[model samples]
Target: MIEWFTAVQVIVALLAGLICLVLGFIGKQPNDLTLGSIVLVELLLIAQLVVTIVAPTVGNEPSGSLAEFYIYLISALLLPVAGAFWALIERSRWSTVVLGVVGLAVAVMLYRMGQIWFVQGTP
Candidate 1:
């Protein structure tokens, strides 16, 4: 995985988390802006998944366990979707809080994926 691209994902995820948290604190459900941020993050994750799949064919495999890395990747990809679904169902400020938690988790998982890509024995 590309370091710079992964860093961008991390930053975006964290920012989204912060935004959701702030909105929740202010007693608001997720609005379009928050939903848009989540969508943006999911798009970035899909791009990363494509890169991960193509990189190995181009001889750019991860240094760490590929299985573990893939698990993280798949989990990261699904997180936002689940969170968004829950948020929609709940339709409350707490739903935004759930999204905030999901965003932060995605950020951490992305960072872990980077480590798995570049650092050996990272599992």
Candidate 2:
């Protein structure tokens, strides 16, 4: 639940989402750029998963519901994989749009995860 790492995730999601969105708008099919963005996001989420596991052991335990935090983290981890598979199967501009949507969705979910882990129910 490190704030700086969460910020980095959010920024990456936003930039990838916006770029894919623009590509889709221009009628581009799911290309390397779109797929690469998903790969990057998935890698970051995997790293975040590791951090989440280690953070508690290091005494950086979450301030809010641990169950909720895990749920968000797991869901965020799945989005990019699913999006990439969908794009590979479909191979259309809409596939690129799906990537964009997943990126944006991950960004929002990450924001909420940060809240649940650090800021929720605190004075």
Report the number of the highest-lDDT candidate: 2
- Compare the candidates by TM-score and give the number of the best one: 2
Q: Root-mean-square deviation of each candidate, in angstroms?
A: 1.4, 1.3
Residue-level lDDT tens digits of model 2 in 4-122:
99999999998889889999989999999989998898898999999999999999999888888999999999999999999999999989999999999999999999998888874
Q: Clashing residue pairs, candidate 2?
A: none
After aligning candidate 2 to the native by TM-score, how far in Å is the CA of 107 from where it should be? 0.2
TM-score of model 2 (CA atoms): 0.96
Give the per-residue lDDT of model 1 (tens digit) for 40-80.
89999999999989999998889998899999989999999
Misplaced by over 4 Å in model 2 are none
* Cα displacement (Å) at residue 19, model 1: 0.5
Could you tell me the C-alpha RMSD of candidate 1 in Å? 1.4
- Cα lDDT, model 1, residue 100: 88
Candidate 2 residue 109 C-alpha distance from true site, Å: 0.5
